[model samples]
Target: MFLFYQRSVHTWFFLCNFSSRKWWNEETVAVVTGGNKGIGFGVCKQFSIAGLRVVLTARDADRGQEAHQKLKHEGFQNISFHQLDVTDAASRTSFAPWLLREHGGFNILVNNAAINGVAIDEVYSKENNISLKDFLVCIS
Candidate 1:
């Protein structure tokens, strides 16, 4: 019983040391798309504060660069900028390779880019008894 107890303690010690070594040496990288402003920018700031290397991307180069500089000026040196237009395949292909080359690997990717549109006529028509499909089609 004493031998068995000693073995268990040794095993636990070895596992703890191994896990600690693995975690201590690992670097985490993150990318936030549409991160120059709004929610994406907030996420980037949070990640940078959390010690992750963050790349904030936007469709406009100037905006992306400006955001990067702003974060840096704010003492978040781990943040950088990249131009990404998700709707364009060419842009995605170019950025993917660049990301892989620069960051070894990315542990996080925040896709916050979106489009919102609302039609007042569609809303009024729905209130006036239009079908759901028709309402959706009208909005589209």
Candidate 2:
């Protein structure tokens, strides 16, 4: 099953699925932001491999296209690319209409895009000295 969270104004909707199933047919589609690298890239790769139509977005058009090509070269055909920057209002505005018209609505979303403030090894080395505020900021 999928759970959807629709923000005010009904501009964009976020969907999350907790099921263990692989592919749920074409009824399911996904849009993953910052999906050109790291965890976001991994999620897109797996979702595409599972047979879902995956739209992976990145701020850099070149990088996004390269990532899409890499995935296709690796045999992930259900994946595509789009330019997006979650922090930019213009990108968000443009994305809304495109998503609604292209996919109708997304059935899954992986907000895997995040900025790391500190190295994991360094954090573990000084666990007791790490302030709560700093820790929260790091994860945020």
Alpha-carbon runs more than 4 Å astray in model 1: 1-26, 115-140
Clashes within 3 Å, all models in order: 0, 0
TM-score of 1: 0.64
lDDT of 2 by residue, 111-140 (tens): 766534465456655775667668888999
User: Which pairs clash (backbone N, Cα, C closer than 3 Å) in model 2?
Assistant: none
**TM-score to native of every candidate shown:** 0.64, 0.64
Worst 10 residues of 1 by lDDT: 9-18
lDDT of 1 by residue, 48-67 (tens): 76577888999888988998
Q: Evaluated with lDDT, which candidate comes out highest?
A: 2
Error of 2 at 89 (Å): 0.6
Model 2 spans with C-alpha error above 4 angstroms: 1-23, 115-140
